[model samples]
Target: MARGLSQPKRIVILGGGYVGLYAALGLQRKLKGNEASVTVIDPQPHMTYQPFLPEAAAGAIEPRHVVVPLRKTLKRCHVLTARVTKISHADKCVEIEAPDGHTEQVGFDILVVALGSVARLMPIPGLAEQGIAFKTIGEAIFLRNHVMSKLDAAASTVDQELRRKLLTFTFVGGGFAGIEALAELEDMARFATRYYENIEPSDLRWVLVEAAGRILPEVRESLGVYTVLQLEKRGIEVYLSTLAKSFENGHVILSDGTEFDSDTIVWTAGVKANPVLATSDLPLDERGRLKATPTLQVEGLPDVWTAGDNAAVPDLSRIEEDPSALCAPNAQHAVRQANQMAKNIVSVLRDKQPRDYFHKNVGSVASLGLHKGVADVYNVKAKGFIAWGMHRGYHVARVPTFNRKFRVVADWLLSGLLRREVISMGQINNPRAEFDRVSRS
Candidate 1:
């Protein structure tokens, strides 16, 4: 359609994550006058800004502000709210399961696989039923309400054991997701207790269990140590080099012979590539990730490209040092890779070779709680309020879309003027109850 020709090239992008959304945006901007038809297929209609999940969970920011609507953002691209069940590269088709229980196959001239990772679960007993994850906006809202409800239950309970158990919070994984969620929620809980006469901040038992020897491995070892100390100062029990063995019946049994009862068990340990890739005809690595070259193209497969967590993209910045080096699966890499992938795709369409993706590690930042954080940027370290400000400023700029950025900033400003919203609308979790009661009446 670019040159007034019919049947424009069809480019299908799987998943509406950072990689998928950004790639679609880039493609729409570059492909003028329908040079190509870009179709983005994802179960969700919006892309969740994961870095802000903790703030949303803490009620520091509204949940709605943390997600970018794909339809609104990608005005030029076709957005499909459906699950991609399988891909047949040989046939240039993908099987899609629609929301209305219908299935269909969609054909494409170029395919972009960006289906991200899912929670890396284990065989631990009771984890599936008792544990909650901190990945989505829904999970963040649920957690905020759940934590508040636990406090309400604790304040009303006469049994000391039940109250203690309700106040005990256990978080597994010391990574950004786990640590940030734990810190933010803990801060919120501490603030919420000021209104309850029966509850006190000192009564809360916050525990962090990590299998590795250190937390915040993204930062320097010294900074990681400092983070542990800061958390310890806040009365949080930091368990390093420990594994969560079992979580049966709200009872947590750790590898280090520590046992505790808690109502909340947050699992943010790690994530693995989406299992949906196994059904695809595309070549995959041992870890079940799509095998991609330095230029973001699928290995030995033309017209197919991959990026993000599900793609084993060669890290050219590290390949000279380590031949097997692959890009670290993070938002920073996903975003940059997506932009480069789009450029490469356009270049290929114009009869040119694609360039390899390369970028050096800038650094990492982690917020312990409000007004408390640690950051290592370009080999320089900062701690406390300054680091926290840097964390917020960096994320606020990277959250995508001017509309979303304005909304998020407004939420932050309003939160400063008003107290944190601790009210738990638990009934939202069971909306059918009222309807059922009315029907029976």
Candidate 2:
């Protein structure tokens, strides 16, 4: 058994997301000299702070600044850019698939199941080919370029029908992601029109469709209503209790029989726990999340721990009032849970009792656009400029390392002094296409 000061324990952390990255950082700080050998495995070399994805999409923040490089940040830990195919806690071994198509079995004394969630895509026709997800930095950058490129094409083309289709943007989802992304990009696209000779803000059609009756359910019902009003005030069409029935060839068909052609389609409805959990021997809830205790340890397994969006931890603050209360799969809870989980892992190493992770959610704040937002933190409700400031302040304070925070702050500061960036590098998305054609010629 790996314990105490006898020898270094081999520790492996899966999924370098908010939980995996932060928990590893915590463990690195908490562990004594040579107490444990830490290894972090993830498909990406960096952990993208998803909260700033909207800002990145809208060019309010540099895309590179929002992601924390794992190798540079975790100097003492082994960071591997690979995917975990399987987890077998009974044998304490995980199957890792490398990027080059090779698989290897990695053994560890301590295992952390931090694999996060993925975009919950529906089985809508044409979605696979046309729908874009807004979860990662790549997708965010693609959206910024795609939207602007459409505007460029529209400006040069005299085809009225094609121009209308290019200008029509449809977003299917009303959660924080869908709302913030739609708001910020719409704001950016509107700002971009200033440079175009023919295109105007009024010429662009922005549509938001949510099957639910309201958007931003993470906030409050009242705030959701206010958001609709704000979007409508900006000439955006907010369709609540509506669903996108189909999107074959960008010809959108809604449940309400609203049909229109759009060149851009963004899907941000919801997410399911990472499907990797199903392949593991660990106990999982109905939603395929790892079953974890309040102390952040995997159910029925002491050496294994789980947290974040992938773990169904009991909501300590609400469990007494509601026994069914489980922590929501969000960044706020994930970061806090990871911090506590790190301490728990260290306690076990030193033969001490671990404490349960608990923190009442402070609140949620969302940016609508430049100088516009809505927030409800600690029941202190706010809207417009006040809420926008709160949203920026909260995220800037929470975005990982000091270096990244400085850069992000500088991005906002510089944008204030200059006009919004309207240039589109759409060619970057198809950098190989031009080269391939040149080679053939």
Candidate 3:
């Protein structure tokens, strides 16, 4: 497939997220003495464990601990920090551009499409310029620094109108990302008020806007109700069945006719499959995800495999009950899918039949800041502190590499023992601004 030098077949993986990282790690272990030459390519040098991003934003975990360095971990594979420009199955090659803006084509005998989903954004007025998305570690750090900066601004300002705007934080989504981000940040900000001379926890107005009738659709409906109650008890406003109509100049207008000015507007509504699929010669489903069978092989396409958010893997666990059920785009599914996909890849390399992936929806767990959470595992429901422990235990076990797990646990322990870290490092966002101004002067 790669023009005759594929005896040790060239395996190229796109997007070093959950699937890429895990698949490479699996291959490194399974393929002995050059069973196949492996390569992994992604824009970022590390694979971020996204579930911990909220805690990273809240200062509960160190930002670096949540990401695994690709080069260090994927030792047996070639790691490339480059953007994939194109994939040509007919040519059996992929075009990539490095940070230096140079492009080149790399031939591959097998291709792994794991370019995960992107934020599902809509054309709302001012949303693009004003809305902050919660996807990457960079965004989490930015949000944290920005939120703290707002607190600093609110404390120093004498003008009530500006203070009100600075203190109001509006989150437009009620899924796991939105709820966790809002909850952790709100909790941290509230704790920070202890040091502020003027600001109070009650003075902060945290608003959650969801168009759906209910939030946390991944969990039990009763748990969703409980989460709303807990947030309400903490003085957070929950606007269910509402939409963010506009965010013109930070003037948030909701479908429910609620209008307010907020300095912070976060969008975590949903995610769509990566748009890169449209550029490739791969079979895609109606939703723009790769059409994959239960075995994680690209439908009707030889030498191509897919998993994670980019692959529309049939939910074999649900097929008995529902004919058209596909795996949801979550870490729970992504991680397991990668493990299975890797083994299947190795099996095919050794000239063996591949097996289908099957894992039941084990249920979901969500953290509502420190020591508070909700969980529904195996039809059993949990709430409050116990659920929070479950949330911590589950993720600590699942996060790749024991080193990262230890660090995350240690960070949690250290955070619990010490006072909440409350200082704002807003200057970090633009360290060169002052330098530029001084040079101009």
**Residue 392 in candidate 3, Cα distance off native in Å:** 0.7
Tens-place lDDT per residue, model 2, 1-441, is 554667799999998999999999999998987799999999999999999999999999999998999999998899999999988888889999999989999999999989899999899998988999999999999999999999999999999999999999999999999999999999999998989989989999999999999899899889999999999999999999998889999999999989999999999999999999998889999999988998999889999999998999999999789998999888999999999999999999999999998999888999999999999999889999999999999999999999999999999999888856878999989999988999999
Per-residue lDDT of model 1, residues 178-238, tens digit only: 9999999999999999899999999999999999999988999999999999999999999
Off by over 4 Å in 3: 1-6
Of candidates 3 and 1, the better by TM-score: 3
> Each model's C-alpha lDDT?
0.93, 0.93, 0.93
Listed per model in order, the count of residue pairs whose N, CA or C atoms clash below 3 Å is 0, 0, 0
Total residue pair clashes for candidate 2 = 0
Q: Deviation in angstroms for 288 in model 1? A: 0.9
Question: What digit string (tens of lDDT, one per residue) describes model 3 on residues 359-397?
Answer: 998999999998999999999999999999999999999
- Which residue pairs show collisions in model 3? none
Q: How many steric clashes does model 1 contain?
A: 0
